[model samples]
Target: MFELRHVSKRHGAIIALDAIDLSIAAGQTTALIGPSGAGKSSILRMLIGLEWPDAGEVRFDGVPLRRETLLEQRRRIGYVIQEGGLFPHLTGASNAALLARTLGWETSRIEARLRELAELCQLPFAALSRYPAELSGGQRQRVGLIRALMLDPAVLLLDEPLGALDPIVRHDLQTQMRELFALLNKTVVLVTHDVAEAVWLGDTLVLLRAGKILQKGGIDELLDVPADPFVHQFMNAQRRLREDA
Candidate 1:
C-alpha cells in the first residue's frame, strides 16, 4: 500500500532517513522499530505527507505522493501520534469530528460515528464531551484513536500512540488494538521503540538505525538470520530487559 524509493531526509546536520527503500503491504501491520534517532518516525511522517524526503520518492497505492493530491490522499489515511496529539481548546468530540465536519458530514452522522468508534476503542461516550486536560492519559489515547478512525480511512499510521501511557493502560490498549486491527483488516504502519510491542503487534518488523533499514522480517528471522549485527543486538537487548525484569 506504501512504497519508499531511495528516500533520504535530512534536518540540517542530522540525517533522519538515508536513501532507504521499503514497501508496506496492504492489510498488514508493519512495525518500524529501532533505538532513538533511528528514523522510524521520519518514515511515518513521510508516508502521511507531513514531511518530504530530501531525495527520492514516497508512493501510496501506486501513485506518487504529490502536494496537489496530498489533501485527497490524507483523507484516505488515519494518523495517531503520541499522547493523542489533541488540541487543548477542543473537546474530544470536537477533535474527532474535525475532519468529517470539514468534509461536510451531518451532525447526526458525526455523532453516530463518534459513538461507534468510542465503543470500538473502549472509551466512554461521555468522555468525548471533555477537553484534553480533562481526560486521563489512557482516555487521551483512546480519543486519539477515535479521531483517527472517525473517517474510517484505509490505512492507520501510528507513531508510538501508547508510548506515553502507564503500563496497564498501554497493555490493555495494545490488546484492544490487536483485535481491532484483525477486525478492521486495514493496512497499519506503527512506529515504536519497544521491540516486544512491535513483535506483539506487527506482522512484519523493520529494524532501523542511523536512518537506514538494517533488517526486515519476522522476529524469528531476525533472531536466526540477522542482516546486521545491530539487528541481533537490538533484539537481544529487548529480551534481556524482560528476562532481567
Candidate 2:
C-alpha cells in the first residue's frame, strides 16, 4: 500500500536516511527496527508527508506523495505516535472524535464508532470520559489507537506506540494488536527499537543502522543468515531479550 524507492533524507550535513527502499503490502504488518538514529522514524515521517525526501520517491497506493495530495492521503492513513499524543485537556472520547467531528461526521456516528473501538481494544466505555492524565499508560495508548481508527483508515502507521508502558502491559497490548491487525486487515507499518516487540507485531522486519537498511526479512531469516557482523550482533541482542522475557 506504500512504497519508498531509493529514498534519501538529510538535515544540513547529517543524513537521516540514505537510499532506503521499502514496500508495505495491503493487509500486512511490516516493522522497521534498529538502534537510536537508525532512521526508523524517518521512514514514517516521509510516509505520512510530515517530512520530504531529499531524493527519490514515496508513494501511497500508486500515486506520488506530494503536498497537494497530502491532506487527502493523510485522511486515509491512521497514525499513532508514542504516548498517544493526546491533548491533555481533551477527554479520551473527545480526542478520539476530534478528526471525525472536524470532518463533519455526526455525533451519533462518532459515538457508535467509539463504542466499537472500546470493545475492540478492550477499553472501558466509561474511561472515554476521562482525561489522558487520568488514564494509565496502556489505557492512553488504547485511546490513541481508538483515535487513529476513528476514521477507519486503510493504512495504520504506529511509531513506538507501546514504548512507554510496563512490560506486562506492553505484552498484553501486543497480543491485542496482533488480533486487531488480523481482524481489520489493514496495511500496517510500525517503527520500533525493540526487536521483540517488532517480531511480535510484524510479519516482515527491516533492520537498519546508520540511516540505511541492513537486512529485511522474517526473524528466522535474520537469525539464520545475517547479512554482516552487525546483523548477527543485532539479532543476538534480541535473542537475549527474548530469553529473559
Candidate 3:
C-alpha cells in the first residue's frame, strides 16, 4: 500500500532518516520500532506529507506522493498521534465528525458513522459528549482512534497512540487495537518504542537505528537472525525492560 525508496531527511545538523527503504503491504499491519533518534516517527511524518524527504520518494497505492496529490491521498489515510491530538474545546463526537462535516457529509450520515465507531472502538456513548479535558487518558485515545477511523480510510498511521496511557489502559487498548486491525483489514503502519507491542501488533516489524533500517521481518526472524550487534542490543533492551518491570 505504501513504499519508501532510498528516503532521507534532515533537520539542520541532525539527520532524522537516512537511506531508508521500506514497504507496507495492503491489508496488513507493519510496525516501525526503535529508540529515540531512530526515525520511526519521521517515517510517519513523511507518509502523511507533514515532512518531505531530502532524497528519494514516497508512493501511496502506486502513485507518487506530491503536494498536488497529498490532499486527495490523505482522504484515504487515517492518522492518530499520542494523547489523541484532540482539540481541547471540541466534544469527542464533534472531533470525530469534524472531517466529515467539513466534507459536507449530512448530519444524519455523520451521526450514523459516529454510532458505528463508538461501538467498534468500545467507546461509551456518554463519553462522546465530553470534551478532551473531560475524558481520561484512555478515553481520549479512544476518541482519537474514533476520529481516525471516522472516514473509513483505507490506511491507518498511528504514532505512539498508546504511549501516554497507564499500563492497564495501554494493555486494554492493545488488545482492542489488535482486534480493530484485523476487523478493519486496512493497511496499518504503527510507530512505537515498545518491542512487545510491535511484535504483537505487527505482521512485519522493521527495526531501525540511527535513522537507518537495521532489519525488517517477522518477530521470530528478528530474534533469530539479527542483522548486527545493534539489533541484538536493541532487542535485548526490551527484554531487560520487561525483566526490570
Candidate 4:
C-alpha cells in the first residue's frame, strides 16, 4: 500500500529520517514504535505528503508522491494526530466534516456521514455540536477519529492518537481501535512509544531509532529474536517498568 525507498528527510540541522526503506502492507495494521527522535511521526507525515523526503522517494499505490497530486492523494488517506488537532473555533462536527465540505458534499450528505462515523467511533451524538474546547480529552480524540474516518479513505495514518488520554480512556479506545482496524481492513500505520500498545493493536511492528529501522516483524519475533539490544530492551520495556514499579 505504501513504500519508502531510501528516504532521507532533514528538518534544518535535525535528521528526522535517514535513508530508510520501508513497505507497509495493504489491509493490515503496522505500528511504528520507538523513543523520542526515532522518526515515527516523520514517516507518518511523509506518507500523507505533509512532509517530503529530501532524497529517495515516497510512493503510494505504486505512484511517487508529487506536490501536484498530493491533495488528491490525501483524499484517499485519513490521518489523525494527538489531541485531535482540532481547530479551536470549530465545532467537533465541523472539524470532522471539513474535508467533505471542501469536496462540495451537500449538507444532508455531510450530516449523514457524520452520524455514521460518530457511531463508528462511538462518539456521543450531541458532542458533535460542542466546540473542541468544550470536549474532554477522550471526546476530542474520538472527534479526531471521526474526522479521519469521515471520508472513508483507503488508508489510516494515526500519530500517537491515544498518547494523551487517561489510561482508562486509552484502554477502552485501544479495543475500539483494534475493532475498527479489523472491520475497516484499511492500510493503517500507527506511531506510538508504547510497546504494549503496538504489540496489542498492530499486526506488524516496526521499531526505529535515531531515524533508522532496527527491527520489523511480529511481536514474537521481536521479543524472541530481536534485531539488536535496543529492540530487546524496547520490546520488554513495559515488563521492566512493571517489575520496577
Candidate number with greatest lDDT: 1
Model 3 misplaced stretches (Cα beyond 4 Å): 240-245
Error of 3 at 231 (Å): 0.6
User: How many residue pairs in model 4 have overlapping backbones?
Assistant: 0
lDDT of 4 by residue, 166-193 (tens): 9999999998999988888899999998
- The backbone clash count of each candidate, in order, is 0, 0, 0, 0
Per-prediction TM-score, please? 0.97, 0.96, 0.97, 0.95
- Residue 103 lDDT in candidate 4: 88
> Better model by TM-score, 3 or 4?
3
Q: Residue 40 error for model 4, in Å? A: 0.8
Model 1 TM-score, 2 decimals:
0.97
lDDT, candidates in the order shown: 0.93, 0.92, 0.91, 0.91
In model 2, residue pairs whose N, Cα or C atoms come closer than 3 Å (at least 3 residues apart or on different chains), thus clashing, are none
RMSD of each: 2.0, 1.6, 2.1, 2.5
Give the CA lDDT, 0 to 100, for residue 118 in model 1: 92
Report residue 113 deviation for candidate 1 (angstroms). Answer: 0.6
Q: Could you tell me the lDDT of residue 127 within candidate 1?
A: 98
N/CA/C clash count, model 1 = 0
TM-score for candidate 3: 0.97
Give the per-residue lDDT of model 3 (tens digit) for 1-245: 99999999999999999988898899999999988998999999999999999999999999999998899999999999999999998999999999999999999998889989999999988899999999999999999999999889999999999999999999999999999999999999999988888877889999988899999988777777889898878887676433322
lDDT for each residue of candidate 2 in 1-245, tens digit (9 for 90 to 100): 99899999998888899998888888899999998999999999888999999999999998999999899999999999888999999999999999899999988998999999999999999999999999999999999999999899999999999989999999899999999999999999999988888888898889999899999988878888899789989889765544422
